[model samples]
Target: MDIENMRAFITVAEHQSISHAAKELHQLQSNMTAKIKKIESEFNKELFYRKPRGMELNEEGKKLYAQFKKIVLLWEETRSMMNEDSPVLRLGLMVSKNPPNFDDAMKALYETYENLMVTIKTGSTPKIEEELVNGTIDIGFLVGKTDMNSLHYKKYGTEKLVLVGKNIDKPLEEILKHDNLIISSENCYYKKILDVLLEDHKAIRSDFVEIAALESMMNMCQLGMGVTLIPESDTARLGIRHYKVIDHSCCEIEKFISYRKNHKITGVEQQLMNRIVTAN
Candidate 1:
């Protein structure tokens, strides 16, 4: 079967509409329909149940979809290995104060392999997990452990969670009661820990601020606009002294490095992973 046909089958199965899949693939609806028909003809089986609403995959179609996805991924990986002189390592990272030391790792990788190329995508843990399963990234650095069976996880390091504010002299209860809660994002793991700490203290903040940039959040906290919870490494790096170490039950969080379980680890990729694991 053609690799393009396999990709088209996966897209149609995901969208359940040839028109939608065609638009996504920048192809005509007729072309998409013909590709599906060709696949079904080759298999001598009706893969889809044509409903008025949309095309739904049959049992055989579901099986083929799974296999085709793997085949497409393998084809891409093989092509990448054959076509490029330099090896490329795609990485996904969760936004955090103290992420893995990829800067040093990449520096070492580039020094060892002159033609090594590295790409990084940063987002929430869930986003990173999704991209990893989709085979967009080879490795992921994220907060906490993941229960994804398709991926394998390793303990990268641990971070000491701390609350940073201008008024470190004040009591925790007073700070929680009066100060605004400044967080990076709604899905941030540190924000969840802060939520639990607040519940434990039964303290309600006056307001909350969501800032995407770490520097901005820290500046806001320095100006007494709000208080934010971050890794103690961040405060030390920035030379911020007006912060208190969180003594709550969730004071520390583990960082993890994840990758797809079935992914074939290349020599360069393995070297980078070794450097990261050793450094951490």
Candidate 2:
């Protein structure tokens, strides 16, 4: 079957509307309809049931959709691996949460493979997960637990979460009454964790000052602008004092280096992965 036709079919199946899929693919509706018809004819099966509002997949279409999605993922992986002229390794790192030595990993990758090109994107874990699923990034450095079974991960280690501020001697309740809660936006995974912690302590955040960069967050905390939560290990590196959160029962978060399971690991890719996973 033609890959383009299969792609159209997948798009139609996902949207359940030929017009919507056509718009997404930037193709005419008539062309999209013809492609779906050609695929159904080739398979000798009725893939979708025509409806007044939209198309709905039958059992046959559901089976084909599942198989074809895998085929598309595999094709993308193969093409990426074979691009030797510009061996770009795309990486997504969660900057809001402290990860283990991602800069060191990139440095090692560049040193080991001089010709390789590296592209790095920073965001929260969910953003990284989205990019990994769509094959936009080859690797992700994330903190916290992910239930995405399609991606395989190597755990770096678990670290304790602590509240850091310039005045480390302040009482926990006094610290909670402060105006500033320096952290990422509402959708951040770490933000969600902090929300639960705050609720358990019966503390209400007076203000949330959004900061994307970890270094900036630390700097803000040091200047006494606001206090932020960070890993205990990072506090030592930054020469700042960190106190354990009130509820010590659930304060640990896991760090990981993750990639799609379908992608084949090249020698250079393997080396990069090793550096990511083995590095402290």
Top lDDT model:
1
231: Cα error in model 1, Å = 1.0
lDDT of each: 0.78, 0.74
Error of 1 at 111 (Å): 2.1
- Candidate achieving the largest TM-score: 1
For model 1, residues 35-154, the per-residue Cα lDDT tens digits are 999999999999999999899999999999879866765665456456658888898877754355668767766765567677788887878898999998998888875579898776
Q: Give per-residue CA lDDT, model 2, range 1-280, as digits (tens).
A: 8777877998788678999888656699999999999988888999898999999999999999878866765554455456555667788877754356557756755664467787778888888888898999888878875669788775667777788767656776676676377887666776777677677779887467888777888888887787777777776777875554645655788877788878765545644654444455
Stretches of candidate 1 exceeding 4 Å from the true structure: 1-84, 96-100, 204-207
* TM values, all candidates: 0.66, 0.62
Q: How much RMSD separates candidate 1 from the native structure?
A: 13.4
Q: Can you tell me which runs of candidate 2 are displaced by over 4 Å?
A: 1-86, 96-101, 177-179, 242-247
Distance (Å) between predicted and true CA of 34, model 2? 53
User: How much is the lDDT of residue 231 in candidate 1?
Assistant: 77
Model 1 gets an lDDT of 0.78
